[model samples]
Target: MGPYGVETLPPGVVDVPAAPAACRAALVERDRFEWRPADGGDPAALTEEFLLGHGLAVDDLTRPAGHDPAGPCGAALYVSAAAGAAMAGAPSGAANPVATLPEVAVVVYGHARPPRPPRRTEPGRWWVGPWRDSWTPGEHADAVQAVRAAIGRGDVYQVNVVGHAAADYTGDPRPALARLAGLPGARYGGTLHGAGWAIGCASPETLVEVTAGRVVTRPIKGTRPATDAGRRELLASAKERAEHIMIVDLERNDLARLARTGSVRVDELFAVRRWCDLWQAESTVSAQLADGIGLAALLRAVCPGGSVTGAPKRAALELIAAVEPVGRGAGMGALGWVGPGRLDLGLTIRTAAADGDRLHGWAGGGITWDSDPAAEVAEAAAKAAPVRALLAG
Candidate 1:
């Protein structure tokens, strides 16, 4: 169950029959209002128009903020990196596994009627095949070097490059999802089951939160093993600090477009926090929303988060497309609830998406001018280790 007591909708009884085939059962909470493109329009545009027309009240409450008290209402959305790239007018290269997923899919929950809670039952383990990387270690290191070259040429200050991995499995993925959701420091964690595809997420990074007209976004950049010495190293690393601040500044600028002049501020900078076995550095940026700022406008300015894309977002995205071999499906997107009086979404970092017998996941870090190609490749492996282990069973 989510922190707010919001549980995933049960199977076989979803009300929204108009949802696309790829996302027919991407339900958030049962007995809540849902909105999606019936005849195939822009998902972002459709959602924005729906929110504006409904005029839902927004309040400043911490997420999983429980139900609305007066009533339960919220929206859970997932937009792939490919979808975000298309929306930002960045070129996405050839189709990959993620390309088979939806461009944008959302499930809005509304009203006081309690949603059906998921049953309490342990999932069964299944056999899994050996994991394989989309790009070999040497090739991944070469890609990192290419990113450093771009930074050297001043094409971009930082670029977040990712690698994809997959392993074949038999039987259900619920047991793996359960294990992932129980991971240490999992704040926004859940599973979404479609016809033949399912996405399991145990994300810790907050992409954006809107409550009581105040908008806040926490961007995480640096990561190290959860050790006393690792914490010290993270805090003292100048390269990590530089990359963190660049993304923070980019986030502040993105929020400023819909925020009142002088209302945007950095609340916290370089705060170390624990997620699973890693210590991550995060910065909080908040702003007061301008009057009449719709959800669409806000999403347009910050759909693909800066931390995931990197500084000079457009340039970084272009380079990412040219370097990375595959696309990021649900990984690095947003997942959480958009309620009547609040909205909370998490960056889909520690996430996995399953289609047929194959389960897919991705991991990477920001590449800067000082980034070591070999170290960067190692970082990707380290980041993916835990998730791979959970799914191995």
Candidate 2:
């Protein structure tokens, strides 16, 4: 759901499933701001051209009375981590077989309309078969140690290593998505179904939000259970604080590109927010969009958000590609709406995708030089528990 209200597909809206050819065709035919493969040309130069070609602009703040705040609108877009990595000039490696979603999917709503409350439905039972993990606990520990070694050698500062889990299910996932949407603090929760696939996300991190002429991104990096003692520990942990600050700096730099000189600032730092049973440390970095900045330029500047991708993003991507065996399909991407004068997207953590009888979910954390390998594995399990339980019911 959007911050102001719930947004749903109106009647007659069609679902375009995850297929390379069909998805590409749908984007080409409907999307006003499509990302082409970045050639050797400068990314900044290409961004300028793309924005100009689309005539995209923020809502004029000085509009006359009675004018809507959200100006001319465009389609809703979902860009996976792989697509975002490609746009950022990084490789996403091989695709995950279990979660075979498109690299990007765009839903074009030809006109702008106010969001309404989502319809409520009765809960349905979903019995999931035994779950399997991509990596054993010991293997995940070794991967964490490898990332720490890279940090020691100055190959990278921090890399977010993730693991995948999947289970077979026997019922419609829409009911499960509905239950997830109702989860506490589920800000960017929704479900999208296509021909043979469906994706449901109840993400908490705000990757990027552009309103009027200001762009704000809240990057969450630290986590602990929501118990009083856990909150205290997270607030006082030097290691977690260091990890959170690094990503905050990275986000500030990303937003600085399109921001007016000296206009970028960290609005909030190391703030604790609750999501389900966990308390996450988040920081808000924002900036005033430079004159003539468009959606394409903004997205290009701050995509594949720093929270999911570690600091020194290119290095982190390299390490992630080297260590993780499976791809991070729908997880760790931007999932939300993009419209005229308004853009809101959440990091696709705590998200799952279903293809046929299989339900796929992923979870992981940042591996810092001081990270405990065993503890990291346990943390991933803690993060995956809520979603896993939701699916099991």
Per-candidate Cα lDDT values, in order, are 0.72, 0.71
lDDT of 1 at 309: 92
Which stretches of model 2 miss by more than 4 angstroms? 1-74, 98-100, 110-125
Taking every candidate in turn, the Cα RMSD to the unseen true structure, in Å, is: 6.1, 6.8
Lowest summed lDDT window (length 10), candidate 1: 15-24
TM-score of each: 0.85, 0.82
Alpha-carbon deviation at 319 in model 1, angstroms:
0.7
| Candidate 1 segments exceeding 4 Å error | 1-41, 50-72, 98-100, 110-125
Clashing pairs in 1: 32-110, 33-110, 59-211, 59-212, 59-341, 60-211, 60-212, 74-338, 74-339, 75-338
What is the TM-score of candidate 1? 0.85
Error of 1 at 367 (Å): 0.4
Could you give me the TM-score of model 2 versus the true structure? 0.82
Cα error, candidate 2, residue 341 (Å): 0.9
Give per-residue CA lDDT, model 1, range 1-393, as digits (tens).
111112432333222211222232333443322222234555566665554444443322322234443443445566666656666778654355633355566655444224344345555557778888898999999989999999889999999989898888876765575467777777776765544556778888888888777899999999999999999999999999999999999999999988889999999999999987899998999998887776666667787888989889999989998998787876877766665556677888988877766888989999999998888888888888888888775
- Backbone clashes in model 1: 10
